[model samples]
Target: MTLDDLTVSLRALRLLAADFGHLPAPDVDVSTVFPERLRLSFHDTSCESLAAFEQWRTALGIAPDAVEARTQSEGRTRVLAAETSFAGAVVMLTAYADQSAADRAGGVR
Candidate 1:
């Protein structure tokens, strides 16, 4: 089993679905464009997104401080990202600002 294995990617996604079932569902990406990785992206306010990202990262056995947090869209959008390997597949978790957050901040809709 390796990151390039489709089976590994699917298995990782299934595990994530089971583990994070209580939280808001993320956008799951398992495209051939990135066959070696699984991308789970969440759109929520900064606080909510950070909380969810922490939970997912911890569940994947990644340290909280290992995350890479930064801002995008000219500092209007906050992005929290982290990557780890699960069951031999690379897993990347990313959370970005939702429309509501941007609207609240008077950003472009």
Candidate 2:
């Protein structure tokens, strides 16, 4: 499916879950979906493995803003994997840095 389709589906999933009193996660640690992917944005970076995150963080002895984990499934099959930064409450991925920056600047939707 297209990215827009994926987003719409995800949003609908969250809303439907919320309707049943199953709210979305307030905080997410991305390290468990795509290990080794160090995503660096303007203010933060993240990885995908909890063990790796802990080891590396211990070595450096610093605090991350947050950590998130997600898993997408279809029946018994896993379909998607990803990671997000730890320092921000909100996140949006854009192909263009300018667009991402603009998105962070204000509510663009």
Candidate 3:
């Protein structure tokens, strides 16, 4: 992430916290591995995570269908993700958890 990218990410986090104060705080990460992207993740059950992602997506004005949902870790983990540009910086909001945990919690598969 560039200096501008970090700046944009911080600004976005601030806004997100202010606007979605009801939700749990996300784990913020900025890495060169993702280049210009800033990743915000929530470690929760699949259902809870998806709900949080949807809330953020809606608040950011992204279309409901503009998301990529997939499974990883040999289908042990379910990942819900959406991307949006904030002040020219790529911001990725993700929610992921172990499928078994969600299953025990009676959450989405």
C-alpha local distance difference test of each model: 0.76, 0.29, 0.73
Clash pairs, model 1 backbone: none
Clash-forming residue pairs, model 2: 28-67, 28-68, 29-67, 29-68, 29-69, 30-68, 31-48, 32-48
CA deviation > 4 Å runs, candidate 2: 1-48, 60-65, 74-109
The CA lDDT at 12 in model 3 is 64
Name the 10 consecutive residues with the lowest summed lDDT in model 1.
100-109
Q: Pull out the clashing pairs in model 3.
A: none
Per-residue lDDT of 10-38 in model 2, one digit per residue for the tens? 44334433553332122222232333222
Strongest candidate by TM-score: 1
The Cα error of candidate 2 at residue 84, in Å, is 11
Winning model by lDDT:
1
Can you write out model 3's per-residue Cα lDDT over 1-109, one digit (the tens) per residue?
A: 3665466556666666777788766788876565556677877754687677777788777787888877787677888888888655687888887687546366544
